[model samples]
Target: MALSVVDLYRDILPKTNCGDCGFPTCLAFAGMVVSEKHPIDGCPHLAPEVVERCNQELAEQYAAGKWTKRDLAEDALTWAKERSASMNLSDLPGRIGGELLDTDSGKALKLPYFGGHVIISEGDITRADDRELTRWEKVFIYNHLSQGGSRMPIGKWKGFEEFPNTVSKIKTMAGHVEAPLVDRFHGRLAELVDAAKRIGGMEMTGKAHSADAAFFFRPFLRVPVMLLFWDEDPADGFGATAKLLFDETVIEHLDIESIVFLSERLRQLLCDAADEAPQKGNT
Candidate 1:
């Protein structure tokens, strides 16, 4: 069979997905190229041979030096349609009833609805009420606090109180939480999910999960403007996680700005973490 577009795109570059093209990953940039949404030149990773090969097919388009822009738009729309069709909220469980809010980063002590607490010391322990234990059932929360370069005493909470044994913490780089553009992007996400709910396409709750509070939404989109916190299982350590598991198509259609913001945030978050975490000198 002929080389698949994905394969072709991968072949011409390092495929390390370093985001040099200003896109989150290599494949995303390739999709834009194949769709003629962006020109091959947009990718800094492109080798001279690859550029020459692409030039032949895009000779006419390149005359105006608009190949990349044209292709980016085309690919973006196609990607968006595919994303919408592929989005599935079905697998996701139903929504919870309360609303709690906190900073995207998990550092803030907001969201009192869940009676959130922390263990500031290694031996520090906070007991949880068995009755309140059930409140953590079936939810998801993303904490942005750990995204900073700071190493917190979070692990201490690991064994404290009734904190679910299922809790998982995600550490990332810094600068994601401070980006101003994130406000509009997250606002849009909130609005979109709300709109989705109005049409019976959503399940939302505003509760914070202490154990897994920062578990959702990382590595994929880590912009400082927004942090996601959720509890997919209330009994499972607050269900907070950092995994970005949106549909492939939805992942494709994600607004570039949103993707950029999130990706940059994640990058910074990870960077910050490495800087702060104790490390041995090169052996």
Candidate 2:
């Protein structure tokens, strides 16, 4: 007879009860493995051969669980609220092509004009002037901004800086890489670069471009993407700017090739944007 999970644990798992796998005890891990909540690989003691067998068993269990289609009871409003909190607006202004939403006031006001004809003012407001973003462009910005936690924009507005300025940082990060995982990453970077050029209309300097280049190419490549944009006056000319810095662990893994790839891709994007909109002045 095949060994039961309990039987396998009694024979195979180390009795040491280490929390290496985060479970409190070997027996608990064993039980969880059987239920498919914990993988067999979590057991440090099983000989590799035994581990493989356990993995196979767990895979079968996982497949069976999938076929059963588990039902979950959930509160609809809570779900919606949780989902809304993850919502992205990076490209919403460009798509909607009207105004930016003021988070505090719950009102949408026209883009590019701030505090000129207003009374109530506290939080920062962001606006995008470009009116020509494709549907996919909008979604890419929205999803990456909203759903990609911690990477979301800090706030839409600051005292003087607004969305048009903020989007440029999105533009910088967007150029970082063409992920081998998907063709969309390449296409999206192109669209972001173009949209940024068309809308923000900023002619970034060699130094600014170089700094952004370092992020996508070397330091940023190593990090597990934590994109946070905020306004900083690192220097006077770099005014009311968006700066992106990643987690340290990610920077450790970067290689020169990654930097080169990022640089080439970014250059292509910038050149393309230049070709598309020669008239717009640099922001």
Which candidate achieves the best TM-score against the true structure? 2
Candidate 1 residue-wise lDDT, 1-283, digit = tens: 2223566465765688899888888788776765554667888767788787775655654454442344453444344334333322221111111222233432222211222322111111122232231111101111121112122122122211122221221211112332322332222333323332332222323443332222223121221112343323446544223223222222222232333334443434443444454443321
Clashing residue pair totals per candidate (backbone < 3 A): 53, 10
Query: For model 2, how does the per-residue alpha-carbon lDDT over 1-283 read when each residue is reduced to its tens digit?
Result: 3435577568778867897878888887776766545667766656788777766765766666632223221232233234335443444344322344465566443432111111111222222443343332222222222232333233222211122233443433334432221232222333333444443333332433442211221111112221112222346544222233333322122222322333333334444554565343322
Candidate 1: what lDDT?
Answer: 0.35
lDDT of each candidate versus the true structure: 0.35, 0.38
TM-score of each: 0.21, 0.24
| Model 2 lDDT on a 0 to 1 scale | 0.38
RMSD of 1: 20.7
Candidate 2 TM-score over all chains jointly: 0.24
